[model samples]
Target: MGLLLSGVLVWQASNAAFVGVTSNANNSWSAGTVNLTNDSGGTPMFHVTQMVPGQSGSRCIEITSASSVPVDVKFYTDVTALPVDDIRPYIDITVEDGTGGTFASCAGFTPSGGTEFTGTLQNLTTTRTTYANGLGPWALDGTPPDKLSFRISWQFHADAPPVAQAGSTPNVAFIWEAQS
Candidate 1:
């Protein structure tokens, strides 16, 4: 009986001699973002103090996606104040994709092949258009960032009665909004 008890005790002690090692692992996660910016430099896009009949002017704005997520870009205009002479009906406004160049020189722009708005500035103010839809998940690898160039052009029609429009529309606002 003594020998049997000693053997059982030895077996139990050997079973308790087993060993183990443990380690911890951890990680973190965060949300993505969508951002948009324009090249206006803190001023209204178009500013014409003196426009003449049969004369046209253009402005270029470059919009970029400084984001890690894809987004849709929309465009609209708000006429804070209308022209005193009500020349809105006589001015033709057109928006196109710029071929290249700055606001002072948009000679590289290409018209949308008649998709442009040929009506008055009043109509344009009330209408909202989709400039870029479903743009992109901009690369963090630094490829040429997802970007778009726009050319906004307007003309005082030659056929308009010159005597009817002597004042200027000084407060027109163009807005760009983005959604992820």
Candidate 2:
């Protein structure tokens, strides 16, 4: 009798089951991601500003953690321009840790995924000629190259923190004016 009942059930299809499967398939069709690749280059443009001091070496600027984007330096004339060039009156910074005001903090930055960042280095300043967007003066005693500038710019990502967190904000000095 059990075998007979099983065979009957298999032969009879339920309307509910059919509807569920159809709905799932239709939903999948509406959820496809559009993939496209377009590449171009131009002169990048940006202005610079100063960073406020924070407690114990951290500054007023903060970024979200766990982001995978890589922050790179690019020059531009407009924010919307791809590879913007001819940026005038730039500044470079020389960061000093709390250990005697002589350490360089090359603050790297990246986009915050979809999140909104309050103080983006790109949007902070806008004086094309008199703006602060140049590195001051720097001497490299470490692994990476050193720079100086006119304004204060910090590039941060989810992974690397700025170097001036353990000391004084003044430990990180701004050199100002970088010709790239």
Report the number of the highest-lDDT candidate: 1
lDDT of 2 by residue, 1-64 (tens): 9999988787785534554333334443333221211111211112223322321122212211
Question: Least accurate stretch of 10 residues (summed lDDT) in model 2?
Answer: 36-45
In model 1, the clashing pairs are 99-109
Q: How many backbone clashes does candidate 1 have?
A: 1
Off by over 4 Å in 1: 1-29, 110-116, 129-144
Residue 82 lDDT in model 2? 23
**Per-residue error at 89 for model 2, in Å?**
19
Best by TM-score: 1
Residue range 20-62, candidate 1, lDDT tens digits: 9988778678976767777777777666767778888778887
